[model samples]
Target: MSGKSGASEISLKQSLRKIEYPSSAKDALNKIVDLICGRITSIKNMDLALDLMAEFVFLEIDRRGHKRGFPLTPLIELQLIELLYEYFNNMSNESARNTVFLSIFSGTTAIMRLGVLTKLVSVAIAIPSATILSSASAWMQQLGNTSQNSCKLAEGLIQDYFYFYNPNTSSINLVPSISPQFTANFLTAVTENYFNFTKRECIFPPKVLMESVTTWVSENPGLCIAAQQKQAVLPPGAIAMEATTPIAGLLRWTVLAPINKQDSQVYGDLHLALLNSIIEIPKVTPPKAIYAQHLTGPINPILSYVNDLRNKQELKLDQILNEDNLQLALDRYAQAIQVIYSVNAVYGHVDDLFHQLKLLPFNKLMSIVISTYKKNKVIIL
Candidate 1:
């Protein structure tokens, strides 16, 4: 072995010596194997580790052949996966977290590449065992701060789990191993805890990671829209909303995300549709007591502002251009917009009076008059 490989092996050995495996024999054996496999990178070191692991496997088989107590490598593999899941929750140093994540992610994908996870394990456990880690890594790589090398490794694994594309069968099918949002929640956790990304930050996953959701949404467009409408009832910071469909979450997250780019125009229509389709807040059939009290607050403002505007419209051009009049006009316009939003929040049906107001000349004049007043007020002030 080269000097670096020898040093790595020595480091590996020192780390193993420090590990205090729990009293359970199976747990202890699995921990030792995990430590050995996770540390050795060189072929020479790997050969030694493999020999040691093989000897342990044979000894266990001999000792418990009739009892069926040989350790399940697949189960051990799942235990190793916990290290990754835990890292996302803890506020560890970024460099250390990335190193640990990349190490396990790369090792798992390498094992996956050899078909060891599928071919060695029984079919019942095979698919799910291979899928859980592989799918999680796919989302992490696509959404997290991953190296190009790590991304390439994750891409290969994603092909196996996201959509099982088979050349021999000439068929591509979505894998039922995991939901898009289940893995997406991992990203949300890591970004929130590890990266400190604020809720407003737009962390768009790579296109490959979103393919399954986008494909499903395309097929069930109506259902997706209905799901989003239900999602709208919950507050933006709602914990329950996370249980909704992944597309609904993504749509709300990317409410301000740009869809005008050349590559994104394809989704612009559906995105806009979902954006506009969310149900209005303060339900149309609110309790009479609440509506009566709340509605007046906004309705009173609209009445006052509209009457003020009518009085101004009758003023001479010179009077309308006065500094005080211009300021009042600007203030009232601002108040009008606020009340408009408030009224819409309460009675948001198409046939509602405010909804009809949007189609009338008054709404058009408000837009034109607000702009003109803002300009004239600037000069007067």
Candidate 2:
């Protein structure tokens, strides 16, 4: 092992010598592949070498145009994909996984930054595993001090994961097992990024976001349940709104969008989870109520929309509604109630809404909402 390690180090050093700053894209990519394939025994050494190589690659690509500098031929993309697959499939060490994820993220981001649209699909399809996904999630959560390039790369990789993987099919079943913390961290990062990005840029393609959230909620039931419990104790106010708004947006988008049957089921599950969490926020107390009242300013518009929808003939109490429409209605109702709670205002008419909802024959959907409200009513301290 020592002899092999020593030889690998020598090979790596030699490979590094061949790479020049601002080198042509083709040369840089070749050197990167060689360094990654070098027989290094230490994962740490391998990670360090890959990080440096990825940084150099990004710099070189940035220095030159995509078509002229780093023309991503099919062969080159295939090589990068193979390298990523080998590293992710073989390495279980967290640091190693983190390193590889960052490296691949950098490489993919270069492709995106250069407007190389065609190659992105290959990269995305090549790199979706439990280890990579979880490690990337953890890395993203801790990137408070990272470079803009690193941040962009991380975001691009996550967006790719959602774009390429469908939640309802056999392919989704292949998603590797991630821990509860991993799920929570991943969801938090995505939600925060979604809000931040939308504020300054166009909304993330809703279809992609929908698919990703559906997959995540389907796979991470335990984490979702834990999140629900956590939200239950939050005093209704601006802080609660900050956390819940993105979740409610996700639920509302999925509920309203046109999706296939499988995704519809997945979205329904997510819808239920969000509703349960919204109901879990503890009733406001004292000074918090004062701040909450200020936040209630925006609730009126949402309430008006809800009342308009409530009077729709299709949504009548005795009418049998389509499953998708029912879920959509429930989601809207949940959003309005959530906003009201965030402001610490008493929604005296919610019981009437609940009664009408219960009168609908959709037992599965209404039962959960009814039970959640009843449980909240019983728990006065």
lDDT for each residue of candidate 1 in 1-381, tens digit (9 for 90 to 100):
488867875665445445442213333344333453353444564454443233232222222224335544665545433432332335233333333333333443434322322221122122333333333333343333233333343334444543464322321223223333223332233222211123354245444444443444444433332322322121123232212223223332232222112125333443434333222223344411012121222233234434555586675534433434233323333343344344343222322433323332233345663455456557968
Give the Cα error of residue 307 in candidate 1, in Å: 34
Looking at candidate 1, what is the lDDT of residue 226?
31
- lDDT of each model, Cα atoms only? 0.34, 0.43
| Candidate that would win on TM-score | 2
- Provide the RMSD of all predictions against the true structure, rounded to 1 decimal: 18.4, 12.1
Supply the global lDDT for candidate 1.
0.34
Clashes of 1: 0
Model 1 Cα displacement at 305 (Å)?
31
Q: Per-residue CA lDDT of candidate 2, range 185-263, in tens?
A: 4444444344232246624435555555665555444443232232211111213211212343344344343321224
